[model samples]
Target: MPSVTVRNVPDEVHRAIRVRAAQHGRSIEAEMREILESAVKPQGRVKLGSLLAEVGRKAKLTDEELGTFESVRDKTPARAASFE
Candidate 1:
């Protein structure tokens, strides 16, 4: 898993987060993660996969047609780009 380090937080802000974390019965780190997650990907967001599936449903694509797409698609591993 990846990790993040937030530097130079104001004392009052840190204290507020600590209080909020305590109120929610979560560690400060866990509370911060939840805060960051909600800030970026909120509950009302429309994700791409859901949108595409909706489009497919409206288009009335059959399972056999979708299976043909899978059979014809590329399965190669991508190569890293060289900056040289």
Candidate 2:
């Protein structure tokens, strides 16, 4: 086992951690560990080119249609990207 010390934590942040620990029925240390784990994890990225290629192959989109579809898709607002 290794010991670690975190210094100069703000009072409000410490108070929030204490509140979250109490809400979750965990010690502050355990709550902090869980928060750190989620914060530091690596996440996946979507490759739009690869995805479009796969969709084209399956759907047999003509070059003109594919271009049109891509143009339309490009104009759409992007939603949040998540990896879970």
The model with the greatest TM-score is 1
TM-score of each: 0.55, 0.48
lDDT of 1: 0.86
**Candidate 2 lDDT tens digits, 21-81:** 9999999999999898788865565577778778897998888977877676655666778
Candidate 1 local lDDT, 1-84, one digit each (tens): 689999999999999999999999999999999999988877888965568667877889998966676677667866779999
What are the RMSDs of all candidates, in order? Answer: 5.2, 12.9
Over 4 Å off, model 2: 43-84
Q: List the residue pairs that clash in candidate 2.
A: none
Cα lDDT, model 1, residue 30 = 100
lDDT of 2: 0.85
Deviation of model 1 at 12, angstroms: 0.2
